[model samples]
Target: MSVLIEVVTDVAADPGVVFDLELDVDMHTASLRGSGERATTGSGRRRLQLGDEVTFHARHLGLPWRMTSRVTAYDRPHRFVDEQTRGPFRSLHHEHLFAALPGGTRMTDRMSVTAPAGPLGAVVAHLVLAPYLRRLLRRRAAHVKQVAESAGGRR
Candidate 1:
């Protein structure tokens, strides 16, 4: 089974500014809502780029979980895509789509995931993981929109 979640918001700023902020790890980390390790800890290889691999240490469902993602595509000031190199899911493909809106950029995040355990895993994911992930992304997307829109996309 494939799982997808998305959210959209308007930013009253320049698209370039919004895009730059999204790519900045430090700037992005500052706005992330969570405790302790929510902020990135890795250095040297911290920058996001094609073929660059990063292990994100985070918590979900009140338990510690980690995601190892490989940057498969990085089109600056436009779009990027990442795939799970390791972690819980059998496969994960996350694509970021952006379009310049009237005043800013209309950003859409598309996430597709395939679980393990064949057919049975799909059911388990729909019942348990899907809801948790949906809520988690909703919170995350809101944070991103707030940061982007408040920073005035022109900055």
Candidate 2:
């Protein structure tokens, strides 16, 4: 069984600014309000391209989880996709889309994930992971909104 969830936020900034932030993996540490410090995977490697691997280390509920993902697809200033290489999930595919709107930009996140166990895992993920990821994205979106709009539209 597979579970998918999508979240959207209207950021008060252009897609260019927000898209840049998404590509900057290390900047994520500062994008969200709180998640502790973050370390870059390739440290000096700052290229966002297909097959680029990146790892994010963080804790949720005091339980540490390392998220390892690779850039699956990229469409400059428009859409980019990443998939989990190794993590709690059996598989995870995340697609990030950005659309330029009238006053700002509309960012959408779509995730397709397969939990470890089978039907049982799907149930647990729907009841837990789904909601959790939704909330996490919401919070992260809020931060991105602030960061993007703070500079009178830049970051």
Candidate 3:
């Protein structure tokens, strides 16, 4: 079974700035400091572009995990998508959308995740993974908001 998670955040910055920050690996790692997430391969420590791939290493649920994702879609300052090529889950797809707002920008993240183990995976995904991922996404959004607001909408 696949789980869909959607998150929205308002930032005091331009859509372009928020969009670029979202693709910065260093910013991502910093935002996930609690989980010890780090970019280990591919576009680590850099801004990602279309077709760029990044492998992340992190500790989740008390276990180490690695996921490699590639940027499959790109629309500067608007939207982008990344899908897992290799990961712990059966499949993972993350889409990020940005829109200009009167005061700032509205950022939305839509993630689809599928766990392994046939029927049992669906249960686990609903009961555990979904909530956990939601929190992580919230944390990431908060961090981005803070940075974008502080940087005055500049990259």
Against the hidden true structure, what lDDT does model 1 obtain? 0.69
Ranking by TM-score: 3, 2, 1
**Per-residue C-alpha lDDT of model 1 across residues 50-134, encoded as one tens digit per residue:** 7766676666667787777777887876888888988889999988766787777777667888889999999878888778766
Q: Quote the positional error of residue 129 for candidate 3 in Å.
A: 0.2
lDDT of candidate 3 at residue 76, scale 0 to 100: 97
- Candidate 1 residue-wise lDDT at 106: 75
Judge candidate 3 at residue 139 and give its lDDT: 96
TM per candidate comes to 0.82, 0.89, 0.96
Screening candidate 1 with a backbone cut-off below 3 angstroms (N, C-alpha, C), the clashing residue pairs are: 14-153, 14-154
- If candidate 1 were superposed on the true structure by all CA atoms, what would the RMSD be? 2.6
Q: What CA root-mean-square deviation does each model show from the true structure? A: 2.6, 2.2, 1.6
lDDT of each: 0.69, 0.80, 0.94
Candidate 1, residue 74: the lDDT equals: 78
**Candidate 1 vs 2: which has more TM-score:** 2
Best by lDDT: 3
lDDT of 2: 0.80
Query: Candidate 3, residues 56-154: lDDT per residue as tens digits?
Result: 999999999999999999999999999999999999999999999987999999999999998999999999999999999999999999999999883
lDDT of 2 at 122: 90
- State the weakest 10-residue window (summed lDDT) of model 3: 36-45
86: Cα error in model 2, Å = 1.3
What candidate 3 gets wrong by more than 4 Å, as runs, is: 43-45
Tell me how far the alpha carbon of residue 83 in candidate 1 is from the true structure, in angstroms, after superposition.
0.8
